[model samples]
Target chain A: MLKHLTAAIALLATPLAAQDFSEGSQARSWNLYAEIPAKFEAKVVDLVCEFTGDCPADCGAGKRQMGLLRTADDVLILAMKNSQPAFTGAAVELQPYCNQVITVDGLMLDDPDLGARNVYLVQSIVPPGETDKIKANTWTKVWAKEHPEAKGKGPWFRRDPSIKEIIATEGYLGLGLEIDEAFIAENF
Target chain B: MRHFTLSLLAGLALSSPGLAAEGTRIQVSGEIIDTWCYYSGVMGGPDAVVGSAHHTCALWCSAGGIPVGLLAEDGTVYMVLKVGDDTQTAGGDTLLRMAAHTVEADGMLYERDGLRYIVVSDVVSDLDITNKNHEDYGNVPGFSIPDPNK
Candidate 1:
């Protein structure tokens, strides 16, 4: 009976030991699609600086790409998707904390393509003293409200003559359309 | 003899880094879309292409230095990048000008993490834009059609 109890205790203790030693094992177990509450404390670095030694003064002034360098794991997490429209969401919130060690709390997103690279969509961010707040899509919303005339009128080349001229001379291909080579050869 | 020849051909195709490194030249048909609006469903859903309806918004986004993407016919979105000699450059003014139009792009194809990318070398407008698969945003709220009578 004593031997049986010892065997059972050993089995229970083995899993506990493994759990404690395995780094990020619990964090990695979260479902990729689920909204996982995540907090990353790291230095904000511009992705462009990784290749070109040109680290911007203010993380590209929120006009260029930015990412988070998780010092704990030595992984660079690309924090923003695009720089156009002055950026939105986490990109905007993290702009002020550029090159500084800050703690950000948000829902971790598993980008299908960049999943292995630890890319996440930040929902909210917090600096040293502040509490967490939702990251708003401010730029896009403002643009949508301001440009009422822009509604439903798209493929701007058809409406604007100046745009057409730009496309013709500058060789700006409209959208990603597969052109018929035969037709091009015959027409122009 | 036939089996041996097939094996040799397979080996050459697999082992040739030069062929893979340079990438395969392909001409793909698709709609040029702004990545942000398309993925986040901000302007519309994922099917939203840069069309006459969404041209203004797309132009605004593209002009602001957004990375352009090609939504191909086969349902693959290629993150369009510039083809440079040594390194890939950001999509420049040319991409902004082409914001939302059905176009055919000729370029080198690359795949990473199940996502496709085309380093655009050349592009042409598909004159028959109506035939392409584009999500139509028909006269949504806050947009007015121009008066041809005026």
Candidate 2:
């Protein structure tokens, strides 16, 4: 009886200890530049659409894009260029996140033409500096305000990336805002 | 109403063309007989140069004389002077109508249909809102407003 009780106690205490460990570690600290209260964080996303024409069923020609901002810890700019496969009739999209950062794990189709290796897992860490810039820069703010559906409540919130499957993987395409290879090699 | 203001402005133009500001100014200058929309050639691009892209231009008349379009030295076509918004009322003297003119207007100078023409910048109705003009309005012909020193 004591052995069973001890096992149950260990199992229950494991999650609590893990939670305590996360709170004590530096990994738990994150800043997702939002207008929320100081104790709470908000989510900001940027959706970009490129006006690529039609393509084959397997290609990512006519598809929308979605990106999110994870908390402040990791500054990852994840771009899901194609929300739906080719022939979906959706427009090519480009989303830029200014004041928010996000972490996501899913399938990302890589394109060699642009020299970028799309990723299934991306984590963006938007700093406080970027948030201030977005607020002050009238051009960036105007674009964000015009497209409320991209940030507001829409089908985008429910469209989750299927992390269970890996469709295809390749090298980075060297697209828009990406990590510098030289900087990564020197630092990471 | 427009005639009264324009005549008053034209009288000012011939009297005080000398008191106009120096750097990139939008003023009406000329002697008593010839009135022209005056602007200076700014060097830098819109982003680099200050007050390089902003200016206000307008046509004026004392009586019923139609305004003429202002032609550049190369005859490349410059200001299309018109009374009010209608071009037919203009005196074919594209120089008399008022519009915002840019100096380095290479962006708008495109070879379309085998003809070369440069488009001026946006037209501003209220120059007083800007604070860049430093000349006293009492001496200058026409009403010249300064740019905002923000």
Report the lDDT tens digits of candidate 1 across residue range B82-106: 5232121222356655566668988
Error of 2 at B82 (Å): 35
Measured by TM-score, how close is model 2 to the native structure?
0.16
Candidate 1, residue B77: the lDDT equals 74
Residue-level lDDT of model 2, residues B80-136, one tens digit each, is: 212222222111232221222222221123222112222223333322112122122
Query: In order of the candidates, what TM-score does chain B achieve?
Result: 0.64, 0.22
Cα distance off (Å), candidate 1, residue A4 = 20
Native contact fraction (fnat) of model 1? 0.02
True contacts kept of each: 0.02, 0.00
Model 2 segments more than 4 A misplaced:
A1-43, A47-66, A70-73, A86-103, A109-114, A118-188, B1-150
Best by DockQ: 1
Which portions of model 1 show Cα errors greater than 4 Å?
Answer: A1-39, A51-59, A69-93, A106-123, A128-188, B1-30, B42-44, B63-67, B72-74, B80-94, B102-150
Stretch of 10 with least lDDT, candidate 1 chain A: A16-25
